[model samples]
Target: MQNLLSIVIIGIGATAVMDLWGALRKPLLGVPPPNYAMLGRWIAHMTHGQFCHKSIAASPSIAAEQIIGWVAHYLTGIAFAALLIGISGPAWIQNPTMGPAFAVGTGTIAAPFLLMQPGMGAGFAGSKMPNPNAARLQSLLTHMAFGLGLYLSGLAVSLIC
Candidate 1:
């Protein structure tokens, strides 16, 4: 139970860090923040057996999609935390380090590149976007920031637990 709690804390913290990066990036780099509503739309359609969309934007909007998307976002963060704990084991929770956390966090980008993006009709690695290269770079940078978040969060968790 303690370990689980610690993981949750770390995960939430890490995800929060990533979100902070997104929030700041818009003003600092002029990169618009990701509209998680699309995530909600994608998930909402999944309930009806619609996994892939030619363009998620064109897909019918679901009621309360924003809520669903935000929920999914946090859940995904927790899941990533679990993944980190599972890979590193309880010992890691006891004395969290930066390397493993960062690796796991950054590695999660594959989900977007291979699965989420393609399913949302953005093609592989956002290839269908107006500027695929820029999109890909942004994604990579965001994940790297997530990796840093994981490390920092792990440190915080270690201090508390």
Candidate 2:
């Protein structure tokens, strides 16, 4: 139960980090505000591998993608917390140590950089975008934010719990 809460918090924090990362990197040539929610949804859809990809805006197939993505996002939150609990055990669940939390955040980079980008037809890290370098930098920053989010969420949970 507590582990579940931890994941929820971490996921929220990850979203927050994503926002900050985008704002920070907005000046970068090719970086766009990454859809952190998309990351979440991707995590969720990975469980099924059914290509559920949706966004909050209007585009071709946006509805299917967004719904699947939203569900996947929440699932990612749960999964992240579960992994943290598994690694630290129940005792840590009560007071998640920072290492595992940050590790989880750091670990989040794999999906976008490797799987999502290529799958989205962006090559790797927005290579398909006009400014691939800026796009790649945006991705890196967003992932780093996710890592920071993990640590921040863990700290919050440890303190509150």
Error of 1 at 84 (Å): 0.9
Expressed as tens digits, the lDDT of each residue in 14-59 for candidate 2 is: 6566567667765764445656445544445555564433331221
Number of backbone collisions per candidate, in order? 0, 6
Q: Score every model by TM-score.
A: 0.97, 0.67
- In terms of TM-score, which candidate is strongest? 1
- Each prediction's RMSD to truth: 0.8, 4.8
Query: What shift in Å separates residue 74 of candidate 1 from its native position after superposition?
Result: 0.9
Clashes of 2: 6
Residues 6-90, candidate 1, lDDT per residue (tens digit)?
Answer: 8888888888998999999999999988888999999999999999999999999999999998888878888898999899997
Stretches of candidate 1 exceeding 4 Å from the true structure:
none
- Runs in model 2 with CA error above 4 Å? 27-31, 35-59, 64-71, 94-98
